[model samples]
Target: MSDIAIWLVRDDALPLGQRLTAALGATLYQPWQTPGDSPREQFRRCFHQHRQWVLVMASGIAVRYLDGLPASKYSDPAVVVLDEAARFAIPLLSGHEGGANALAYQVARLTGATPAVTTATEALKPLTLGIGCRRGKPLHDIERAVLSALGTRGLAEVREVATIDLKADEAGLLAFCERHALPLRVISREDVAARGWTGQPSDWVQQNVGVAGVCEPCALIASPRGQLIVPKTAFDGVTVAIVEDRPQTAVRHEP
Candidate 1:
């Protein structure tokens, strides 16, 4: 099921709701009645059911209804409130970890409204990953290797995935990126070679893929000014590297 739920009250709001659903890939929940359940009752049921909620009504209405469903920020789902005219998107609760702040910004972009984001942690962006694998390596192996590498450094999220162009159609890699909704950057072998490798030279990779190392090279090239934060680490047949892009100059990573 899609994690998003949108509630609309009036027919006039339907057009705006439809536009939001298309932009945000959300499911619409009209305040429909089922037997004795009224629209408000249905809204209450849906509020507890979904991971994220977008109520296209006055902010006051959302505040009044959500008063009873209160929980800790760690446990509550993201809640966003939008005006009927779509003029403003306010992250009513769980603005950071729950993703309401991001969702509000997304809704604002779709409807030309102002996104009022007040959460401090929302300012931090997700990390990007560059990876390489054996010809037929399974997805779980890649995932385990990457997760282990990230865990060592206390990093949690990935913004994008990068690999040599040769792996663009690699079934396991492609499926993994798609499943996680990560934008995949396919760097050409020539470009990766030009960037040069930061990791130890691998004669096997040099003979097979014409690169000194696939993971470190791809990661370095993907972030133009970034240096390797995590050097090429191998697990099973997969290799993972991490780079942190600085705003201006690159910083050296300790070996």
Candidate 2:
């Protein structure tokens, strides 16, 4: 049996729970499975038995259930809270020491949900790359485009790569991410259309992809509080934009 447990309170979320179970090789637990036990009892049992947990329910409910079960960051299970809508995957506990942040990113990649990781280590990362390219563009072209955009910066400062969902399975993009070991975050077309970005609109993108533009919008969406440091720069067949995360403001002392 896998060490990961996926828990859901509602019947409606069962489908998503099952999908996660299959993807993560996790065991699924629902209230209906054990009629004799209360929901809390079932959750408690799974909580102690599993090393990692994916909770498919409201954040409030997950918090209430997890109230006293946690021991410490060192020993507590990694807990990720996902909503029924599957819009966001948030790492609720054990963000670093227990791997909740990594689990959240994996869940995001699997379900196309945005990973809302709030850990300081991740939040402090400087840049996110937004890329768009023609289908079948080679890894070298994509790498060159990204490197050209980075100029003085190195890949180490990039937190992740952002792109439209259409390119989520693009071979070259996947290869580039794999080569650099960077997490790829994909934004849906619907999300791209809904979000406001300042990049020059592209007729090709609008007619073909049904979005205003790809690179800038995706970078802005991936790092919601970030600013585009490098606007859309085009190579032969690829476009790349770089967004820098807003730096934390230092508190000023009255002298």
Candidate 3:
């Protein structure tokens, strides 16, 4: 078995992600296709076969199955979804917090397909993960390290502008914050787009803030004018309509 495992739906033709799997040495588990298995029962069989690490599911079937499980049961395996063509790579389930994000980039680089990333912190550049997740939560050493890594010269300003539909396994970010005692500012999408970012952003979150969790303590909201920096990721997956951004209540302060 490979370091990462994928539960896939079997099909004809060279599936889009087969090359990626071969390259990554991912163990492909096709429980549904096993003989004597009932199509109706595939959900159960697939569920029983699930393990930790990264999982690349084929259709909404897996999404519904996993979502039905309680949130605590989410051991937070990095999850990515690939359409039948494999032309598009979508990190729907555990994108950033779970490590699905980096995995998506890997798949995108290998397949030459566009990664459909939709996190806020990643859209902007030089974001601070320590400040995004736990707003009031203090991050001590981790804050200092992030400031040093990003080389933020001026004072730090935070705002929670808007919220995106965020679902991540924030272990790395949470660790950084706890060590440093960093405080996050919450804002709105309209706020991010209304006002340009002031402080430095982290490299990871800069890739795609709204699609990527780079801005942890903040979400990246975009508009015709520019972008807004929200405090948290989006809630309620149904409404991509996004929220509005008001002036940042927090100013340049600790972290």
- lDDT, each prediction: 0.76, 0.90, 0.43
lDDT of 1 by residue, 56-114 (tens): 98988887778788678888889999999877889999987788876886676466565
Instruction: Summarize candidate 3's per-residue lDDT along 1-255 as a digit string, tens digits.
Output: 465665555554235436666877876665555778654365444443433323344546556756664253245556666655655667665665665655765565455434555655433322323234333323343344344433343223321122222312234444543344332223333344344343444444445454233233233322222233223332211111212333345788888
Encode model 2's per-residue lDDT on 101-129: one tens digit a residue.
87888899889888998888776778999
Which structure is stronger by lDDT: 1 or 2?
2
Query: TM-score, each model?
Result: 0.49, 0.84, 0.43
Candidate topping lDDT: 2
Q: Which stretches of candidate 3 lie over 4 Å from their true place?
A: 13-17, 38-59, 123-255
TM-score for model 2?
A: 0.84
What value of lDDT does candidate 3 attain over all alpha carbons?
A: 0.43
- Mark the regions of model 2 whose C-alpha exceeds 4 Å error after superposition: 48-51, 67-76, 110-112, 196-198, 247-255
- The per-candidate count of clashes, in order, stands at 0, 0, 68
Residue 127 lDDT (model 1): 57
